[model samples]
Target: MTNHYYRDFLIRNWQERDRIPAAEVIRSVLSEYGLGWEPNGADKDVLQVEEYYLATGGEFWVIEYQNQLVGTGAYYPIKRSEKAVEIRKMYLLSSVRGFGLGKYLLQQLEAAIASRGFLSIWIETASVLAEAVKLYESNGYMPATGVETTRCDRVYVKSLMTNFY
Candidate 1:
């Protein structure tokens, strides 16, 4: 389902070949905010994208710029609210900030989740990620609780039942 192309960037489904570069991109982005990549803890999914995402009812995507893996975003059905899905692993390289790619990827994820019959979407993020918080809030993700990750301080949810798209 590689249908998105913005400027010179491309968004496509994750492949086995993307594992290493994708992990590098994710770790590099996390390090920018003084966060560590917890492959055995918070980020265990990155190491098992097949089992945790694709093998389940979820999808994971990789972002490419000039043929280089630069970002990632994914969502998996969670036992949360009605038909809920948790948006996870959204990260972009520092050089790609302010380019609207994050917003585009988020919108794409929402569309996919809704199309898959998900009624609500949840996101857990740290307050340190001011831009991410702003993006989610601006896109109608209201404040919520139940943050399960140790690194995250907040959780936000958007009800897709009211969304026309």
Candidate 2:
């Protein structure tokens, strides 16, 4: 099944057409990660691609299946930094896992980041997301230690130029 399935996926910078599906997929993925809940009057906590679009000139890629959104990923410049970008808010619907979509997304994100003159990229995922960690490792990202953050996340970093095929 994995080899036979091909995603009708299109990745682009955020646009008005993507508002609802992007929001819903983000909410669903965050819920799966236990990070979806938002308190009343805290709508700002929701990470909307459109909002990031306006703020950081960030780029968003949405995966669609039969015209329905099923996955997304984004890249944004890190603040106070030069030539560095962060791969943020990457998620795919559960049904799409194990078919190499994650690898594709990572490669696309790295390409986008590098195109913008960024020399390196980093991502932080929950330590419990072992599959994600392995994906990063297999893609040449090294585990980063001693990152102090409240989220207790596991950090991974990779230099974009080191292992290009």
Candidate 3:
């Protein structure tokens, strides 16, 4: 068995073989966040959203250990009056928890956004995703008032003042 900790995981652009495993990891994480998937209903919606993100200029960074995908972080431009981008889906398989990978992924995403001259990065997450909420908070994102979704999603925004590249 691969030791996830000792293995070198590369974070790179998404590929075709990554689709299914990435979807599965995200589905599992969403379930843990109380956003359970239903094959014929919400699950389909989730998949469609993923497809839409890919169709746009969205980029997915997949983490692999010994050729096995274990997590993903994606970002796409969101329609806004000001230059901004959104951090869409981000997930790490259970085995990689507590390894600082989340922070690493966020940093990369932020750098990519900033490099594009976007002034801010925004993200939304259901309230049940406490860990995600904390991650955003710790990374300088501030809560913003917005129309809540059926899933009680909360919006957070982080301003990127300088180019990180």
> What is the model-wide C-alpha lDDT for candidate 3?
0.73
- Per-residue CA lDDT of model 3 for 83-131, tens digit only, reads 8777867888778878888887888788777776888888877777777
What is the number of backbone collisions in each predicted candidate, taken in the order shown?
0, 0, 0
Model 2, CA-based lDDT: 0.68
Clashing pairs in 2: none
Q: What is the C-alpha lDDT of each candidate?
A: 0.93, 0.68, 0.73
Q: Give the winner by lDDT.
A: 1
- Runs of candidate 2 with Cα error greater than 4 angstroms are 1-6, 38-51, 145-152, 163-165
lDDT of 1 at 63: 92
TM-score for each candidate, following the candidate numbering: 0.97, 0.78, 0.81
lDDT of 1 by residue, 16-74 (tens): 99989989998998899999899999998998999999988999999999999999999
Cα lDDT of candidate 1 equals: 0.93
| Candidates, ranked, lDDT | 1, 3, 2
lDDT by residue for model 2 (65-135), tens: 77677887777777424566777667788877888888988887776677677877878777766678889
Cα error, candidate 1, residue 73 (Å): 0.5
Model 3 residue runs over 4 Å out of place are 1-7, 38-51, 147-149, 162-165
The candidate maximizing TM-score is 1
